[model samples]
Target: MPTPIKMPALSPTMEEGTLARWLIKEGDTVSSGDIMAEIETDKATMEFEAVDEGTVLKIEVPDGTEGVKVGTVIALLGAEGEDAGTVDAAPAAAAAPESSESAQPAASEPPEPTPASAPTVAPAKAASSAGTRTIASPLARRIAEKKGVDLASVKGSGPNGRIVKADVEGAQSGSAVPRREAAGPATGQAAAAPAGPATLPDFGIPHEDEKLSNVRKVIARRLTESKQTVPHYYLTIDVRLDPLLKLRAELNAALEAQGVKLSVNDLLIKALAKALIQVPRCNVSFGGDVLRSFSRADISVAVAAPSGLITPIIVDAGSKSISTIATEMKELAGKAREGKLQPHEYQGGTASLSNLGMYGIKQFEAVINPPQGMIMAVGAGDKRPHVVDDALAIATVMSATGSFDHRAIDGADGAELMQAFKALVEAPLGLVA
Candidate 1:
């Protein structure tokens, strides 16, 4: 009897996810804690670790499969001294079948609903006059289509001469006859963005539909919900940034020995965290009739990654030193961009900060991340005429807008938080102290 490997719930909220890629294949030896695959959850792409040490006897779910439910057996592993090849798939039958609706495959393989069952078929004979369909992996067929390699012309080298990914990759790229579509578990390509009445009229213009990744999809859903359900009110403030900029440069020079550098956003994250501490009324989440106020300020700093917009939390930013915040934020941003952030690293926050100053956007209100009371939107810092010592003087200034959830925070409380933030940023010494 072989041990069944199930699809893991990568996050607390993940119900289903895409098995983006498989690192271990059939007949591969794996130890406990070894990364076996990458699962794209609702929040981020995370590596799935192996739980039991054994030889992978069968991979029920192939790579590139989408909408695989949690607890579905994805593979089977053989114990020590067991023949990996001769073992029956009886162990797999004990597991329930997958019922992922979004899975793409030919209509002929409809009886078995899951990806694990879709690819277990006989070898495909090259197409001639008989109309016998080809047997190829979903990924192989996608590659063939992209390279225009006729499946009928290529020889399959997989089990019983089944067409697999290697066969397609080794085949020469050229013009060929129509491809005989193979019935398989999942396509190699990302699911293309659904075309529908949901989209606008093309008006006969040429266009290509791109797929929305899991991250992008979640972002869209959450942001849309935030806007529609959350009663939001905006408050804007102009803060003098020259002192902060000067302090940053001085700090960087002094800390050059420690190799710590600070960005304007880093300072702002600290300011917002401290502001939340100063005005606890604004650092809260509205849960129906309940208002939950946080004792410590965890600031969610928005960072744009290749996947989409993600807010990595700087936990207790108000408590950590400036150098500590800079270091942690840099690390988090790097991990965020690479899609490697852990769940806790990106999940919860008391307040949020989004900086468009680096991009030179002057001012804009950001949507509040759900359950959080507010998000500070910071814009570009540029030299402007400002009052100094009761006289007009030139100073570097930046505009920041706070988008507050009116259900949780009153306008006055939100304004107080903003005022505190501005004073802290302008003063520049309270943050370090």
Candidate 2:
């Protein structure tokens, strides 16, 4: 008996996947755990593995075929002697057969179907002609096609893993993926954009303009809704960071031999989390009519990846050790840069943090990420003259701005949270405890 291999939903939100490539060819013996193909979900490229031992008997979808919905048969696998084309395949039997081989008796002893079998020998001619490669995401490939971008030239940034619009854009910008040109016009393209604009008659192909990539699409949608629907208020606080600087220096020196360096950002994250525990309102949101507060503080730290900005959550930041937070942040940042963040990994933060301190930004405000009530924008930590005990003293001061959802949090609550955060930074010891 032959079994049909359907495209599995790699992620919760994956409706369809682009069959990026087949690792094994027809007639090739495949075993359980063998990677059959690379699938492109909306989020990332992921490997599709075989759950049952069999031979590649058929492939309905040729490489580069797009718009194949999840649970659609892309390939077939069964015993070496079994002709998949000869297997009785019904509309309902489609997804079931793929799992049946592994779900029940082995290939030699497949359980008889309760329903009568239909004629097995469907001609291989009915199967699509074999292509050189699989192109994932029809929309992405179409975009690439219109832009004269090569599907093979772009690397997929999407999840089990297929190419998406971001991959194409990244390729076009000459950023993530390199361009292949011969000092002349590229193939499948017409005249390029003007280097110097002239009053030449509009001479390019007419096409409808799209707004942005799906990631950008979602970002724009969420941010717009947040700004429009959520009443926002901001509070600014200047933190005396001289104590934090000295403490961080000492902590780094102590931890340097351990191959772990504590960053000021790490300290700040811890401080904010602790302060949120004391100022519970800042750690909460208005769940429409209900006040939804969380016991655990998960801070979403904004990171700019190749795809765009993705905030990887740092869970239980208020309770986690500084070293642990630093380690987790490093890991998340690394994966974020590679666009390997999982959905839950970037979602569901109680609050968010956007730090431009390393970029030497003196001060800036942030838009609140919704459901979560507030966002903290941190500025560069630099030396400034301050009055300490009524005497002038050179100290490090950092400007911190908290953008709060006024619908959920008032000016007093925002100020209280900022005051607590300021005290923590100045003391700089409570955070470590």
Candidate 3:
């Protein structure tokens, strides 16, 4: 008997992923906990592990396949003493239902097919056929359920007349079946317009059209939604960095023997965290009917990766030393670049920080990453003439802009947060304290 290996939902929000690579091929014997495949989700590429030990009997979906829906059978595992080749030849349509009692291990029976995978027959059709079942893939069944479509009325296009994801989606679009609104606070939002034809007008121009990667697509969609939905207001403040720069040099020199060098961004992260603690009103998230205010400052620091920009969080950063923040940030940034960050590493934060000082950008306002109440955008610290005790003086200064979600944070609270952050950065000792 053979067991099916279905595509797993790796992340909470992941509906589908690209089967980036397969570590085991057909006929390869595997043990539980072995790395089976690499799945590329919208956020990161993660290794999928084998849960049940068996010989790889068949690979239903090939490697490098994109948009593989979760719960789709990607492979089959033959039980001990079962011939891998014979297991591969078994009809998938019959294997699912007939092997229910015999194939599965006694300790752990296979999960029953949900409404999405079960053959759904309309009342009239069920009456006509008496006991015939509708055959659909699990993904198809879920989509059918979401769309409120009668599976019996829809035609199956999969092998042996089984309904798949495409079949359910196509059926919904073509039929006049009313769709049930998805249940959530974010429901009722209109679907984004489908991309127009890829054909561009050719005026005898040479160009390359590279496709958007999953990461880029997710970034674009999420950012667009953020800007469109979140009510954003910006507050900018200029902070003289002379004191912070002097202290940073002194601290780095002392910590050099300990193999720790702190960057200005690291200090900024600490400052932001402290500022959040000082002004607790800013460390909050909008939750539709309720506001979520956190006592700890979990800062999400933006890092640019090959795929796209990702924010890896520093949990409870306000309580951590500057050296610890630097070390953790370096490791998290590395993992982010390698696309190996787990969900917990980059998922939530009380606030966000985006620093473009290294690029020498003067100043720029960043969009808030919801449901975070605010984001601090730091610009380059360059030598500039400024007022010092009512006299013009040259000093290293940088502009910091705090983008606040006006819905959650009022203008006065946002300004207070910005002032607190500026004061900490300029004072130089508060960050360490």
Candidate 4:
């Protein structure tokens, strides 16, 4: 009897996902912990590892198949000394073809999605890592086609020399044959818009539609729900940044040989966590009948990724030194961009910090990510007139806004947290102490 390979839940909240790619095919021998496929969960594109090792008997879901529910048997594995081709087709409903050859996905690939699975984002090279197919990431293929680059000639850079989006962007044209463009949808993707039928009438504008990745769709749905259901209020404060900047320079000089660098956001994350400790009332989540207060701050830092904005948490940020926070933040951010972030790397935070200072965004209020009581939005620090020791002088200042769930945190408590955050940033040394 062959064992069925069901789609595992990649996250605590994932119910279904797009089977982004199948790294292994039928007749391939796999072992425990082998990465068999990439699944696009609601949060990120994560690798699905094989737990039961055996020869790949079948692949029920072709690459790029969407909306596959969790626990769906995606493939089957044959025990040692078992023949893969003769495995029962009845298990996965012709998971293979009717012919003698089994688990051939190209035959099932259709024009509907315009090679919907065309991108092997982490592309397999001319001879794939699996030694069976040429793979390019879906995005890479789309861009390659649009840019007149041929996949056959471009070398891949991903694992096993897989071609990724970045690789495709810089590759020289591999063909002058003028490959025909695969037409389906436009390439426009929005983090805030749900990808589906156009909800409004078009004014005869020439545009092609692009399918929304799972991450974009989830962002659109969740943010909409948050705004509609959660009662929100905003509190803004002006904080001087000169002390923080000065301290950061001193710390970086001291820690340079250690290769550790601190950003304003890292210090701010620590300040927010400490402030949450000082005003515990603000560190809470709202339940309809109960308010859940937290003892520690797992601050979710908002990072802008290729897909959308994701908040990877700094767990127990209050207890970690600023250097540690900077190190962890760098690691988490890299994972977030690569779409390899695990569920625990991003889920369940008591609060969030969204910094746009680098982009020179003067000030903006961020919408609160639900269940989390509040989000601190930090803007750019510019020289501004300020009162110091009862006299007005120019100071490096930035505006910070806290968006709180009125249901979970009182306005006064939110104010106190803001005050504490401001004091910590202004004094600066308290952060290291």
Candidate 5:
């Protein structure tokens, strides 16, 4: 008997996926739990594992083909002694053509039925001037061809209307030349008008533009939507951290023999969780129809990867010890950089933290991740003077900015939440039970 391997749902929001590579080719033997292929979702490229042990009979979807819906049978597995190629399954689409130049030319490829669903484009024609036998600018010709209008029908209004770029485009595209309005209050000198458009920069370079991976495409679409549709506001506060720094050195010294090394980020995470408990309003999401609050606080911490950025959470962070949080953070960061994080490792957080202290950023704000009420951006700690007891004194300070959903929380509530966070960080001992 032959078993089918369907595409699995790799993440909660994943719909269709890209078959990035085939780890096991047809006729190869596979065991349960062995990796079979790499699938790229809208966020990251991940592996697909074999669920049943057998010989690979046939592969359906080929590498680089995307929009493969979940549960679509991607491969066939046959019995140990069975001939694999004859197993009946849905007719596999032809594998994507290999783009490498060393491979055989496309003309030598096997015949494939052209899918009726594929998009088609009509050919374009170059536009020429009416009476004169001169060629128009490329931009004008393209605009004219798309409009299906004759360039001869347009009247040039320049020195010769000279059939310049704008004249041709305006005539063919049916763009109206603005009627000169009555001169404004500044009309006395020469009726000076605003400068018209000049040739723009050639921002695009001639280079290979590889199609975006499924994860990157989705991330771009979602982040654009969040930025455009969601109303966001930011508030920043400077926290004095001299006391916290002293506590960190003392704690690390006391725990050195126990092999526990805690970082400033770990201490910040603990403080953030405790602050969320005190200001429960900040640990919430605003559904357009309802306000949702969480009993347990989950804080998402940002980690930079080679491909892009990813945020992994520390669940119930307030209840965990500094050492435990530090250890788990190290592991999570490692997995994130390697692009091997599980879906659970990156999803579902009530808030997010983006720290750039390692890069020496003095201050910055982050966009809020959707469904999360707040995102905190932390900057590097630096020495600065502050007035204390009516006298100026030097102190270590770190600036933190919180970007919140205006719909989910108000300015006063946001301020209160930040104040609480500042207190928790400034008084380091308050974080521990």
Candidate 6:
């Protein structure tokens, strides 16, 4: 028997991926656990392995195929003693009749009592009473969705009553399938405002359109949803970093012989983790009916990659020393830039930190990554005039803004967390302790 190899979900959130490459060719013998292909998920390109040992019979999906849905059969493998020819012919035989019927649609008897202008309530009701699932090809379903044609109202003409592309296209002109309505807003909520113009006038200027990568698509969708669904509030505070800067210099000098160095961001991550521990209310995720709070802080540090911005986490960062955090961050950041981070390396976090200090950003607010309660945006530390003990002084100051999900974190708790972070950074000893 020929076995189909379907695309595996690399991560819990993964719905579709790109078939980046095929490592095994037709007729190649593969063992269980052997690498078979590379799949590009929204976050990383991961190698896919074979689950059953067999000879590769066919590759159904070619490399570079984008938007391949999870569970899609990408290849076929033949069991022992199954000839390649026979294995290849098995799938073809199953689909051959369907293809012929689709190709010769005109030969079939015309649909009776065509409901070209009338509503298709009768056919829909009949389909529902039959209790048979609608069998539509992926392409057909996509086309039907775009044309707003209900598949239930249209009778399939292909083999085994399977719906194909021709069935959808032909039904559009012959049947009055009601268009699917956009889901209404929740009760008592106003409908979303109409979207703005989709494109701007070209004005005779030539331009190229590049397709968005999976990472970019996910980033755009998630950020948009976060901004729309999460009720957000921002709190900003300025911290004097001269003490921390001096401490970091001394620590680096002492640790130079041991090959350990730390960045301001590292200390910031430690401070944030400690502050979350101090202000537990801010370290919560909104779960609709319930709220989830963690005893230990896992901090997600944002790193910009070639494809998009990703947040890789440092688990239980509050318990780790600053030097350890710095070391782990360097490795994670390197992997992030190379798109090699695994699911666990970047998945869940209690809170997030995004530092744009290296770019010299004075201050900026970041969108909270749900179901996280807050995200702290760290700006650059620079010399600024300040009042110390009622006397004018120049100190190295940095602005940190915490964006909180108002549903999960109250304004007072958010402010408290921010104040705790500021105090820790200013004192510089709590982080070391």
lDDT of each: 0.80, 0.72, 0.80, 0.79, 0.72, 0.80
Give, for candidate 3, the lowest lDDT window spanning 10 residues.
119-128
For each candidate in turn, give its C-alpha RMSD to the true structure in angstroms: 8.3, 13.1, 9.3, 11.2, 15.0, 10.3
- Tens digits of per-residue lDDT for model 1, 1-433: 8887887877666766778999998889999999999989877889999988999987766677555666767778889987655556454353424233323232232332323322333222346346765656555665666666777767777543556778888998874543344333376533232232224587898887666778887898788778988999999999999889999999999999999998888888889999899999998988789999899999999999999999999999999999999999999999999999998999889889999998889999999998898899999999899997799999889999999999999999989999999999999899999
Comparing 4 with 5 on TM-score, the higher-scoring candidate is 4
TM-score of each: 0.79, 0.69, 0.77, 0.76, 0.72, 0.77
Task: Estimate the lDDT of model 1.
Answer: 0.80
- Candidate with top TM-score is 1
TM-score of 1: 0.79
Model 3 lDDT at residue 308: 93
Error (Å) of candidate 3 at residue 166 is: 20
Against the true structure, candidate 5 has what lDDT?
0.72
Encode model 3's per-residue lDDT on 1-433: one tens digit a residue: 6788887877776766778889998889999999999999889999999999989877765566565666667788888888755764676542333112223232132432333422333221111144577866554654565555777777777544666667778774423233323222366743232231233555777877665767887887778778877999999999999999999999999999999999999999999999999999999999788899999999999999998999999999999999999999999999999999998999899999999999999899998888898999999999999987799999999999999998999999999999899899889898887
TM-score of 6: 0.77
What digit string (tens of lDDT, one per residue) describes model 5 on residues 1-433? 5676777778766656777789988889988899999987756779988888889876755555455656666677787777644564324332221112212222222423334433332212223444443323223433454454455565544221323346665663543222133233465433233221212244775544344556566566566767876799999999988878888899899989988888999999888888888899999987778889999888999998776788888999988988889988999998888888888888888888899998999999898888889989999999899765588999888999999999988999999989999998888888776
Candidates 2 and 4 compared by lDDT, better number: 4
How well is each residue in 1-433 modelled by candidate 4, as lDDT tens digits?
Answer: 6787877778766766788899998889999999999999988999989898899876766677665666666788889877765665445352322121232222222212212322322221234345555555445665665566767667777533556677877887655224223322365432222123344456887777777788997787778778977988999999999999999999999999999999989999999999998899999999778999999999999999998889999999999999999999999999999998998999899999999999999899999898899999999999999998799999999999999999998899999999999999999888888
Over 1-433, each residue of candidate 2 has an lDDT whose tens digit, in order, gives 5777877876665555557678888779989999988775555556888999988876655555444566676776777667655544524454322121222222233322322222222111111134434334555654554455656656666422456666766666322122232222356543333221222355695645443444564566567777877888888988988899899999888888888988888998999999899999889977779889888889999998765677899999999989889999999999887767776788689999999999999999998888899999999988899888799998788999999998888889889999999999999889877
Q: In candidate 4, which residue ranges exceed 4 Å CA deviation? A: 89-195
Clashing pairs in 1: none
Native-to-model Cα distance after best TM-score fit, residue 77 in candidate 3, in Å: 1.0
